[model samples]
Target: MSARRPIPGLGAAPSTDLPVLLPFDRGKGRTPDIYLATRWLASLPPWTPLLILAVMLAWPLVAHAQGRYAYSDAFDALFRWMPFLVFEGFFFNILISFLAMAIGTVAGAALGLAQISLNPMLRRAAWFITQLFRNSPWLVLLFIVLLAFPFEIVIGGVIIPIPDWMKAVFGLSLPIMANISEVVRGAVQSVPTAQWEASESLAFTRRQTMWQIILPQCFKRMIPPWMNWYAILTMATPLCSLLGVEELITLSRQAMEGEDNHPELLVPFFGFALVIFFMYCYPIARATIWLERKYSVKL
Candidate 1:
């Protein structure tokens, strides 16, 4: 090779990767922002820990003082007390919500499948149920459930004696089931015709194509939405307290006495509400994002 002659414009372009690895991003693979922040953090190592400590220490007081903490307080309190309470009040709530979601999911999928089903009765029934629940208000449905009967009214008065707790369960279930039916319907419908076609090529029943191929993938897409709705349900638990159920919000208010009447006591009680909310949600939010990144093909 000839001695390298100076070549105009031959200088190498700057590489994005740096010599130093980031603490949080070292095992996290590549993220340019993370690396940049890491380098900044490494250059001033003391600030990172100090800042985190400052944030943790400051969270409660900021809420007490009313500064850049209104949003923070809601979450901070949630993480702090959510564990002891969320599951406690909603021990039954989760059960009922999950059951409703399951029933709605199955029913919606059946209808979606029914749109392609061989049986006319199955198809008609699915559509009818969907339309009926869609037009009805969940709160009204819940009220109707509460007053329905000693023996639960099954369409056309089938002989099913419903328990009180089960009646509450049914009441909560109605709207949730209705909404989730639509969610599941959309998710099932979103699966490509190609995927269904491939499954069919393999001699899969429409049900088999849905269960094995479509629903699993559809569920992943459904998670963030489900978590959101689930949070809404948690917030709405106080409404159930209207029926004299002793839930967390009920307890928090019981402690508050009144927001306008008692400021000092309200702070602690408000703190109580904050604690309950964050305990369940903040971690779940963090974990949900982590899960989405970890499991999501698109991420």
Candidate 2:
């Protein structure tokens, strides 16, 4: 213990007599630390977020089921009406999505082609229309169509009533149409100039060239984005519930309210609705990815 520890350019070595403590271990019957658990979770794969969300959602549901709300009569009622709900709202969602896709594709393709028309007037007109719809908020467009369109058409004393749900379909289709138009325009432009020259060399007129040569090639490019748009459109169809369309969410609400309007039933009813939407949308998303990979042009 004498004062003889001074060194010229080196520090004193750490004392070997002191005990060293390793990082905290969750063994020896000790409780696990929250920080370590969180760190481990954070180190998981990218898909863990979705898995965590599923777990978070399911945990409460499991707890509620095992706890005071164990009877789950609301779920029984929901199950009882499952077929009806599926046939009504779920069916309508699919129907509305397809209808919008069909109309939007046709109208959007027309607008896209027109945007690149030889005539300046047609090009300007198409641009104006596309910009109008594309810039407008979807909900605003839906309301406009819902309110502006006549409830019924009177022609020669024959009345043809337009259902509110049909109006919703029209509203949803507007945005889809504008988007698909852009997809068409971009896909068409993505084609190589050499293809255009080859078509011209084959005596193909501009219209003939677009339809016969360029468009066929554009289809491959268009499909992946089209499926993507379809998925989006399907998700957006829930907005129709606001318009009294009795779509999935609307019907779910009705079911929940009809079951004595119990607070305990809220999670289960909505969870079922979430499952329904997930089942429908998940496949489209997977298919979109697959198609994009499959149909992607080599060029």
Best by TM-score: 2
Candidate 1 lDDT trough over 10 residues, lowest sum: 33-42
Task: Write the residue-wise lDDT of candidate 1 on 1-104 in tens digits.
Answer: 56775554464443445585545656568533312322232244333444544664555566565444354444444455446455665465555556555555
Q: Which candidate achieves the best lDDT against the true structure? A: 2
The lDDT for every candidate, in the order shown, is 0.56, 0.79
- What TM-score do all the candidates reach, one by one? 0.53, 0.77
How does model 1 score by TM-score? 0.53
Model 2 Cα lDDT, one tens digit per residue, 54-119: 753565557555435444465577778799789987998899889988888899999999988989
User: Residue 125 deviation, candidate 1, in Å?
Assistant: 3.8
Candidate 2 clash pair list: none
**Model 2 reaches what TM-score against the true structure?**
0.77
lDDT of candidate 1? Answer: 0.56
